[model samples]
Target: MLNSRFDMKDMDLAHVILGIKISRTSNRLTLDQSHYVDKILEKFSNDDTSLARTPIDTSKHLLKNRGEAVSQVEYSRVIESLMYLMSCTRPEIAFVVNKVCQFMQKPLNSHWKKKKRILGYLNGTVNYGLHFTPTHLYNLTWLVTRMRTGHLIVMMRRSTTGIACFWVQILSLGNQRNKRYTVSRSSTEAEYRSVASLVAEITWIRGLLQEIHVHSSKPPIIWCDNSSTVRLTSNPVLHARTKHIELDLYFVREKVQQKN
Candidate 1:
C-alpha cells in the first residue's frame, strides 16, 4: 500500500514553541518559558544583582525623564521583549510592564533600573507558569466572579475598577479600568461602577461560551463584599444620588432579570 512506502517517527510530546514551554499530563497542562526568561535575564541583567521580592515597588514613584537619558533604544527593546512574555504567560506583570513602558521615548536611569527590577523578578519566577486542571465534565454549576475598587494613588481623584472571571476555578479572563469614564462621587459609587463592569464582563463570557456550544443549566453568580452595591442591583429604584450612574444600573438590572 502507499502507506507502507513512507516512514514516520513520533516525537511523543511538544516541549517548546515560540518561546513557550508546554508540559502536559493526564489531568493538567502547564505552559512556561523559564528558558526564555533566563535568556532575557542573561541578555539584560548585570552579574551583580539581588532578586526583588516584587516585580514593582509601590512605594517608589516614577516621573518623566527630567534627568539625563540612558540608552532609550535599549530600554525600549527590553520593554518590548518583556511585553511579549507578559502577553503570553505572565499576566501578573501587566501593571509593572504598563508602568515602565510609558517612558519609552526617553527613559531615565530610574526607569531603566525599574525595568531591570522586573527582569530580576522574572529571574526569580522563571519556572512559574499557568497551570490548568480539568474541571468536572458535563457540570455547568461552576462560575466565579470577583470585584475590587481603589482610588488611583498617582492620579489623585481618579478611581479604578478590577474584575476577574473564573470557570471551574481556572482564571478565564480579567480586567482593570481606570474610571476616567466618569468621576465617582464616593467609594460606594466606585464600587458600584466596578460591579457594573463585572456584570458586563460576565455577560460577554456567557455569550462566548454559548457560541462555543457550552450551555449552563443555571445562571452565574457574582459575589461582592459591598452590601450597598448588592442592594443597588436589586432595588430597581434610581434615587437622585445614583442618577450619575443610572445607565450602569439599567444594564446590571436587565442582566440580573435574565438570570445572568
Candidate 2:
C-alpha cells in the first residue's frame, strides 16, 4: 500500500523504462532498446555505416594510442552512450565496450573506427534483446570467458529454465577490466583470475538472496573451459609458479571446499 502513504496515480503499463522497451507475451518477456540504438547511430553520424555481424573486429589488436588523439571529444561521447546501452540490455557487447573504454582518454582514429564498428553491429541486431520465460528450477551457473590477451574477464549467469529445457543466460554479473597493474603470464592464470572474480560475485549474490529469503535447491556451479584452471581449483599442491596468485588460489579453494 504505497498508495496509502503517498499520492500516486497508476500508469497503466510500462512500455518503456529508462529507455528500455519492454515487450511481453503469455509466458515470455523481452527487453530491448532499438530506439536508443538508432538514436546513438544517428547522433554519431553512423546511420549509414555498413552493417557488421560482430561487435568488434578480433583480427585487429586494440592498443593504447601513443600518437596524437583523434576526435577525442566525439570518441568519449560515443563511448558514454555505448556504456549505458551495454549496461541496460546489451550485455553481449560488454567486452567491446570495455575494450574501447581503455582509450577514452586519448582515443586514436583506430579507436574511433572500433566504436563505429560496434554501432554497425548494433544496426544489424537492433531487434535483439534479452528474453525470459517460465522456469521451474532456480539453478544458477556462472560462466567465465578469458580474453586472448589475458586482460579481460567476462562472467555471466545462466539459469536452467523449463520453457526451452536448455540453459539460458538470465543475468550478466560481471564484465570487469583488469584491476591488477600486471597482466597474467599464462592463459591458466588468466582463467583462474576470472574464476576468482566470478566466485566473489557468486558469494555476494548468494548472500543477497539469503537476505531476501530465497534459497537455491543446491550450491551454484562455476563453469570454465580451461582444463588447467579447473584442475588447479581442487588441487591441494601449490607450485612456485603459482606463488604470485596465492591469495586467489586460497580464496577459491576455500569456497570449493565448502561446496559453495
Candidate 3:
C-alpha cells in the first residue's frame, strides 16, 4: 500500500535481451528470434547453406543417442545451447535439438555435422520475433454441454475461448462405421450424424471449460470441414433424409437460428 513503507525497484522491461527476445509497447508485447537467429547464422556462416522447405526430413529416422559416447563437455554445451534456444524463441530447433541431444552420450560424425548445420540455421534467423496480439476478453456463452469422445468432436479448448480461432486434429478410431446408425442412409442423414458427433464434442468441451474457468460467447461455433454438413444443418424441416434425426440435433439449424 502507498501508506506502508515498502521499497520496490522499478525495472524497465522494454527491450529484447540475450537469446530470449521480448518486445513491448503500450498496447502489445511480442516474443521472437529474428535478431538471435541472424547472429547465430552469421557466426556459424550458414547464410549460404541451402534452406529446406521443411524442417526435419520426414523420411529420416533419428533416435536418441544410444550407440556410442561423444566427448561429454562439448556435446553437453551444444545441447544446452539448443535447449535454451528452443525454450526461448526457436521451436523449429526442438526436433533438431532433441535429435542432437540424443547423441550427447555417444555422438557420431553425422550427428556432429547436423549440429553444425542447425547452428548455421540459427545464425540466419536470430532477428526473427514471434508476434502475439492482445487477448480479446469475452463474457460467458449460453450453450448446453454434452460429453462424447472421438475424432469428430475434439475441438481445442484454446480456440473456443476466442484466443485461437480454429485447430484441427485427425484421430484414428477403431470403428470405421457408426454401429448405431443404419448404413445407406440419405446424404442428409449422414450429414446430420456427423454434426451430432460434433455437437456432442462441443457440448462436452464447454462443460469441461466450466469445470475450469473458460467461457465464450453464446452458441459456440461448429465449423464442419464438410460444407454439405453445414447446409444440412441450416435447414430445419426434417424430411425423409433428416426426419430420423431430432430438432435438438440437426443442431446446425437450431444453433444458427439463435445467432452465434
Candidate 4:
C-alpha cells in the first residue's frame, strides 16, 4: 500500500507483453499475438506460401532421418519460436509442434516441410486469440477421450489420449498426452490406464480451482466410451484378467470412490 511504503505504480493498462497482445472490455478479455506471428512468417519467408488447411498433414509419414538432414539449425529455431507461441496463445498447434520437435537433432526435408506448414497455418490465422467471458459453472463440462492403445503409431505402439475441458461452449483447455503402455493383454487394460491418467489430470485441475476459491456443488462427470473400463473402476471386485493392471485399478477406483 502507499501508506505502507510499498513501491508500486499504477499502469493504466497493459496492451502487449512478450509479443502477446491483450485486449479488454467491460465483459470480455482477449489475448492474441498477430504481430509476433507476422514476424515469424516474414523471417521464414513463408508470407508468400499458400495457406495450409491444417497445421500438419496427418497422412504424411515422417520417419527418423535416415536420409540427408536439412538445415537442422534453422529447423530448430523455427520449432522453438512456434513452441513459445503454442504454449502461450496457440495451443491448437501443440500436437503438430510436439510431433516435429522429436526430430530436432536430425531433421529431414519432410520434417522441415511440416514445420513450414505450421508457419503457413499461422499466417492464415494471425488474428486468432483466446477469449475469456463470464460463464456459470453449471453450464461448463469436461470431456476426456482416448484411442485404443497401439492405435496411434504402429511402429511405436503407443496410444494417444485427449482431454478437452469446456467452460460452457468456450474451450478452457484442449490437449493430448501420448501414453506408452507396457504390452497389455487387451484393449480394455489400455483404456483403463488412459482413464487413470485422465483422472490424475482432472484432480489437479480441481485442486487449482479450489485454490482460486471456485467451488462446484456437484461432482464432475467424465464420459468414457469404454464401458468395460467404466465398470472396472466402479466395481470393487478384482477379476482374474485385471491382475496385470492392479495398480492402475486401485488408483482409479480410489478416485472414483472419492467422487473425483
Predicted structure with the largest TM-score when compared to the true one = 2
Off by more than 4 A, model 4: 1-7, 136-140, 147-154, 167-169, 173-176, 179-185
RMSD of each: 5.0, 5.9, 12.0, 3.1
Residue-level lDDT tens digits of model 4 in 1-260: 57469878788789999899999999999999999998888898454477877897877656774457899889989989988888788878877776788788888877777887887788789999889887676333566666543434335655566666665456665355464546555678777887777778778877877898887767776777888998998999999989988998999899879976
In the range 1-260, model 1's lDDT, one tens digit per residue, is 44478786667688898989999999999988888898898898887556987998877777773567899889988999898887777877876786677678878887888887898798789998878897553222322222222232234455545454455665445533233456667766777777777777777777888897887666877776677878888887888899888998999888888786
The parts of candidate 2 lying over 4 Å away from their true place are 1-9, 66-68, 150-168, 175-180
lDDT of each: 0.73, 0.75, 0.50, 0.76
| Ranking of all candidate structures by their lDDT, best first | 4, 2, 1, 3
Worst 10 contiguous positions by lDDT, candidate 2:
157-166
Instruction: Report the number of the highest-lDDT candidate.
Output: 4
Query: Total clashing residue pairs per candidate?
Result: 0, 0, 26, 0
Candidate 1 at residue 109, lDDT? 85
Q: Global lDDT for candidate 1?
A: 0.73
